[model samples]
Target: MADARSTAAYLCGKLYATLWALGVLGTAAPTPSPLTPGRDESTARFPRDELKRRLAAAGAHMITAKGRGGDRAQAASEVFRSIPDLIPVAGLPQKRYTNQEVLQFSQGCAAQLTTYREKYGSLLH
Candidate 1:
């Protein structure tokens, strides 16, 4: 099941790029959309130290949290790991990015993903 979700997320990322290329979805214009808080952030470049700080601020612990239906921590980790795949759209020349930029880019990607899900709900399922 985790494998399936991972594959789905990978496919979703690819589909987003395809849609953007086809102009179905907008380009990575770097504009502040409702999903992304643009102006509030300094730049779209989150460093490791900052990332650790942000995670710490969020009270993220190392313990794995599991539930009856599924392991959400694992799922979230999987998603977090997949974030690097979005660097192109985020306009990050390097792997490193700002937390706000990362968040904004993530929000934009998620928004595009939501649109994709709505458009191809049956196909994906």
Candidate 2:
């Protein structure tokens, strides 16, 4: 909930989890493990080029949707908000992540996310 504590990787992990649960990332069925864990490249590291495109697109949709209807906590407003609330999501071109950002997403992907899933999985579904 606090900006100080959350990171992009954590947020991206949440995004990836939701996509997986809704059957968006890989199969039409929501299965166990993102991109089949050890099999797919995205399972370990999200495709950098594609992630930016999808994230920007998703962020644009969020802005539009939020403008039309107000937000509830379930929407993970903080993800968009953590877009720093300054940098326009649509203009994310030329963006580069620091080491910290890379590390956080890695943690979100592989480890340290069990508690997050346990705590927030219901809201997501």
Candidate 2 residue lDDT tens string, 21-120? 3232112233456545466444335435544554556554455435444332334454344334422244332344555554555555444235435655
- TM-score on alpha carbons, each prediction: 0.29, 0.40
Question: Which segments of model 1 are wrong by more than 4 Å?
Answer: 1-92
- Which candidate number would show the highest lDDT if scored against the true structure? 2
Q: Mind giving the per-residue lDDT tens digits that candidate 1 earns over 1-125? A: 33322333233333332233222112213323222365423223433343334334222221322221133344333333444464344332345444544444444546555664565443222
Worst lDDT run of 10 residues, candidate 1, spans: 60-69
Cα lDDT, model 2, residue 56: 51
Clashes of 1: 4
